[model samples]
Target chain A: MTTRSPLRIEPTTPPDESPPMRPSDPLPALPPPKPDPATVPDPVISARSLCVWYGSSMALKNVDIDIPRHKITALIGPSGCGKSTLLRCFNRMNDLIPGARMEGTIKFEGIELADPSIDAVALRRRVGMVFQKPNPFPKSIYQNVAWGARINGYKGDMDELVEKSLRRAALWEEVRGKLHKSGLDLSGGQQQRLCIARTLAVEPEIILMDEPCSALDPIATAKVEDLMDELKEDYTIVIVTHNMQQARRTSDMTACLMLDEAAVQGGHRTGVIAEFSPTEKLFTNPSDPRTEAYITGRIG
Target chain B: MNLPVPSGSVERPRWPAPSRFRRYQGPVMLSLLAICALVTVLTTIGIVAVLGLETIHFFRESHVSLPAFVFGTEVDPPKFGIFPLIWGTVMVAAGASLIALPIGLLSALYLSEYAPRRVRAVLKPALELLAGIPTIVYGFLALVLVTPLLKACFEPLGLKVDSYNALSACVVVGVMIIPMVSSLSEDVLSAVPRSLREAAYGLGATKFEVSTRIVLPAGLSGVAASFILAISRAVGETMAVVLAAGRMPNVTANPLRSVETMTAYIVAITGGDASYGTPKYLSLFAVGMTLFVMTLGLNILSGLILRRFREVYN
Candidate 1:
C-alpha cells in the first residue's frame, strides 16, 4: 500500500538504545584492545597488514586480525565490504580467482601461507571451508562425506569415519537410513549440514564458513548456529555473516568491516576493519562511529 | 459534502484504449512460428514415405528373398546380404570411437577446467573449424595424405598397408567429429555450477582431481550423449569412407584392408546409372532406411540420456 525507499535514512534512536553516531567523527588511530590473555585462547592464524586487490581496485586494505584457537570468530559487514574476501584469504581460496592478488603475511600455525614452498593442498586439508550456499557433490550421502577422506589417502575404516563426521555435523540421526540416496535430494538445511559433514570428514583443525546460513530458513540457521557452538570445542571457526544477530548469538570474537569513505578513489571505497573486539563489548560499546551506525541499523 | 468519497468511486478514463491489433499479435506470430516448425516434420515424413515404398518394391521382386538378402553369402547371381556393408560401417565407427572419445573428452576437460579465458577464446573456435570444413575435403585428405603416411610408417615394419584402406578413413572421420564431441561436452562441463568446483577445492582436492572426479561425473550424461551423436555422424558419413576405403565389401576386421561401408555403397550405387524401380535402385532405399533407423535410435538414446542424468542446481 505504501512505498518505502531504501535510501531514505530515517535516523530513529530508540529510548533504550544509544544515539546514532555521525560518519564525520574521526576513527581511533589504534585498533580495538585485545581480550586479556588469561581469558582468551591463543591465536592459531594471524594476519598482519594484509592487503588484497582485484586488478587495480583494492578490496581489503591493511587488515590485521588474529583468529583464536578453538573459538568462533565472526566477521560481520555490509555487502562488498570484503567479509567474504577476508574469510577466503584464511585458506588461500582467493588463489582460485583470476586477477585477485594479495600482499602481506598470513601465518597458520607458524607456517607462512603465502610462501611458495607451502603446498595449498596440505594447508587446505588442515583448514576446510563450507560455502555460503550448500554445495554437496552430486553423489550419494555416504560418498559426499567420504570423498574428501578418500582423496586425502585416509586408511581408517570409511564407514566409521562417515558416521563420525555425520554425527559431528548433527545430521547422522536424519540421514542414517538413507546414506545411499543422492545428496541433492535432501532439504536445504540438511544439505548445508551435509556440506559441514563433508568438511569435517577431512579432519581439519579449523573451518571457514562464508555466510553459511544466508540461504537457509530460520530453523536451519538456528541449527547451524547451534552446530557452530558445539564445533568450537575442537575446531576454530571464522564465519562471515551479513546477519549481525547470528554473529552475536554464535561468536566469541567479532570484527566489523566497512568501506573507508575517506580513502574513496574513482568511486571505489576500499574495505578496512572498523573495529575488532570481544563480541559482547563490540555489540554493547563500539569504539568506532561507523560500527555504531552499522550496528544500530542507521547506515551500512 | 461532509464526508469524502472512497477511491473506488473515481472512474478515470484510460489515456489510450487497448488496440485489437495488439491482442491478435500473439496468436498471429504463434501460427507463423508453428508453420516454420512443421517444415522439418513434413520433410522427415516425406523421406520415410519414399524409403518405405521403394523398400517394399525391392522385397517384392521374384529373385529377392528376405533370408537371402539379409543372411546368404552367395556371389553368383548377386546375393544381396547386407552383412559386409554393416560390418564395414561398425568397424569404421568403432575404430573412430577409439581415437576420438578419449581425445575429445580430454580436450573438453582442458577447455572447461584448465585453459585460461584468452586461450579458450582462440582455441575453441579453431577446434570448431574442423566441423565447418567440407566432408569432401576430408575425403581428399584421407585419400592422399593419411593413407600415404600410414603406408610409409607401416611398410617399414613388414606389414602391408593398402593405398585405399579403412584405417585412413577411420582416422580422418574420427578427426572430423572431434569438434562435435569436444564442443558439446565442454558446454555441459562448463554448465556445472562453480559452487561444486569450489566445494571440492575447499576439501583439499587437486585441480586434476576436481576436474576428473567432480566435474566429469556431473557432466557424464551430456558427455555420453555427445559420444553417441558423434558415433551417429561417423556411421552416416559417406564421402570420406568412399575415398579412402575403396569399394570392396569384404567383412574383414583388419584396418589395413580396403572396406566398403553402407554409406559408401549407397553413394556408389546412386552416383552410377541405375534405372528407377530396378532392384539396384530399390536396394538404395533399403540401405537408406536402415541408416535412418540407426541414426534415429541413436538420437533418441542421446535425448533419453540427457533427460535421465541431468543434474538440477538451485
Candidate 2:
C-alpha cells in the first residue's frame, strides 16, 4: 500500500473537550486557599509535626495531617516516600520494626496516642490494618474470621460474629461453602477479603490499609473500592496508594508525599507531604507544583 | 532505494556441533547421580542384612526362651531380658523431653520472635555451637559433674542416688539435645511468614499472644519434628548413657537407680566382654535392631502428627 501523505497526524483531543490543557494551563498568580480549621470538624486522628527516624537516618519529616472520622483518607506518594510508615503510627505497628523511632505527638479520637502510658495492644484493638498484599492466616476461613474476636475476648455468639464479619467484608457468599477449608485455598482477591473480614471481626473504629489493592486485579480493586465506600459508615479508613486514580475513586481526603531533598532540610532525603486537601480539590486544582507533576505522570 | 535490514537474528548451528560437551553431559551426569543414589540404598540394605543375620543367630543359639527373655528380669547367668534396658531408655528419653520441650521451645520463641538482630546474630551460632560439642564431652560432664550434684540433691530427700544413675544421664542428655530442638524449632518459627505476625499484632495481640497463638501453631510441624528428633537422639544415645548409667542390668522404674540401656548393653557386650560370634555378641545386633525400630516408630509418630495438624502455606 502506498503511504498517504506520510501518515496523517490528527488531534487526539475531542472538539467539545477542554483539550486536557486546563489542568496544566497557566493562570493569574494565585495560591491555594487554605481550609479554615474552625469550619472543619474535629479530626479523629491528628498528627502534629510528626517525624520518624530509622536507626541514624530520618524517613519522614514534619508530617502534619488530620484524619477525619468515618471518612477515607488516601496517602499517595512515590516509592520510598514513607506513606506506609505514617500508617503504622496510627496503631503503633512501627514498634515492631527494629531501630524505628518517632518524634512528636499523634492524637486519636481527641486523645493523645503517643503517650508512654498507652498500651499498643489495646490501641490496636480500636484500630486495625490491612497490608499491601493479601495475608490470610494459614487457617480455615471460619477460624481466620473468628481468631481476632476470640483473642479480643468477644463473649458474643462466635458463629454469628464470623458470619457477620464475613458479610461485612462482602466475602461470605464466596467463602460460605468452604468455611472449614484452609483460607489459602481461595484466590488472591478472596484471601484479601478474608483479611478484611478478620480485621472487621475485631470491631475496630479505624482501619489502615497499605496499598491494599496493589497486588490485586482491576476487578478485585474495584470490589475493594466498593467495599470501602460502604465501610465508611462504620469505620474511618486511611490508605496509602501509589495509584492516583484509586485515591480519587475511593477517598474523601487526599495527601500527596514527595522526597524532602537536601536543598532545604540538611542532607537527608526524607519524605514530606507536598499537599493535602479534599480529593476533588487536590486532583482538579492541585495546590503544589510537585503534586501536579506527579499526578500528571511527569515525575516518578 | 534499498533500506538496511535489522540484524536481530540469533546465530544457530547448522547441525552436529563440533562441541560435543553439552550433548553427552546429561546422561553422564545422570549416571553419576544414579550411582550415588544406589550407594545409599545399598548401604542401608547391607546394614539390615548384617544386623538381621546376627539377631536371628542370637535367638537361636542363646536358647533363652523369647517370652522369658523379654519378660523375665533375672540376669545372673544372662536371662537376656530386655525390660530393664527398654525401661532405662524410655525414662531417659521421657525425662529429656520434659526438660527440652519447654526450655527449647521457649528459647526458640525468644530467638525467633523477640531477640534483636545483633543479639540473634551472636546467640544463634553460639547455640548451634552447643550442638557441635561431642557427646563424649557430655558423657564426661554427666559422670563427673551432674552425677554428684544429683546425688547431693536426692540425699536431702532421703533417696539414695547412685553415682551412675539414669537421672544424671537424662539431665545431661536433655542439656545435650537442647541445641538440636531449639535451633530446628527456631528455623521453623522464623520460617513462619512475617504477614502472620502482622495480622496477629494488628488484632491487638501482644507479643506473648502472637508468639504463642499464631507463630507457634504455624510452626507446629517443624517444632513437633524437633521434639521427635530430640527424643530419638535420646533413645539412640550411647556414649553419654553408657558413662552416666551403669552397665548393670537391673530392671527398676526408679530414676535414682542405675540402669542399663540397649546401647550400653550392646557396648558392654561388644567391647570384648563377650567373644566374637558368641550369642552375647550377637545380642548386640539384636539390641541395635530394637533401637532402630524405636527410632523408626518415633519418626512415624512425628510424620503422623505433622500430617494431621500441618497448615501448609504457599
Docking class of 1: medium
* Worst lDDT 10-window in candidate 2 chain B: B5-14
Q: Taking the tens digit of each residue's C-alpha lDDT, what string does model 2 give over B1-314?
A: 88775465336434556568788899999999999999999999999898888778888888877676666676433677787777788888888778888889999999999999899999999989988888989999998899889877889999999989988888888988999899999999999999889999999998999999899999999999899989999898889888988777676778888988888887887678988877777778877887888898889988987898988876
Would you list the C-alpha lDDT of every candidate in the order shown?
Answer: 0.85, 0.84
Best by DockQ: 2
> Which regions in candidate 1 have their CA more than 4 angstroms from the true location?
A1-41, B1-21, B62-67, B73-77, B299-314
Q: Per-residue lDDT of A1-300 in model 2, one digit per residue for the tens?
A: 100111222255222232211212232122233453222378888987677777766677667788988899999988988899899989989888887767777999766776756788999999999998898888999999999899889999999999999999999998888899999999888889899999999999999999999999999999899999999999999999999999999999998888764312344557777788889988998867888889999987
RMSD of each: 7.2, 9.3
| Candidate 2 deviant stretches above 4 angstroms | A1-39, A263-267, B1-34, B64-69, B75-78
lDDT of 2 at B193: 93
Measured with C-alpha atoms, the lDDT of residue B231 in candidate 2 is: 92
What DockQ does each candidate score versus the true complex, computed on alpha carbons?
0.56, 0.64
Q: Determine the C-alpha RMSD for candidate 1 after optimal superposition of all C-alphas.
A: 7.2
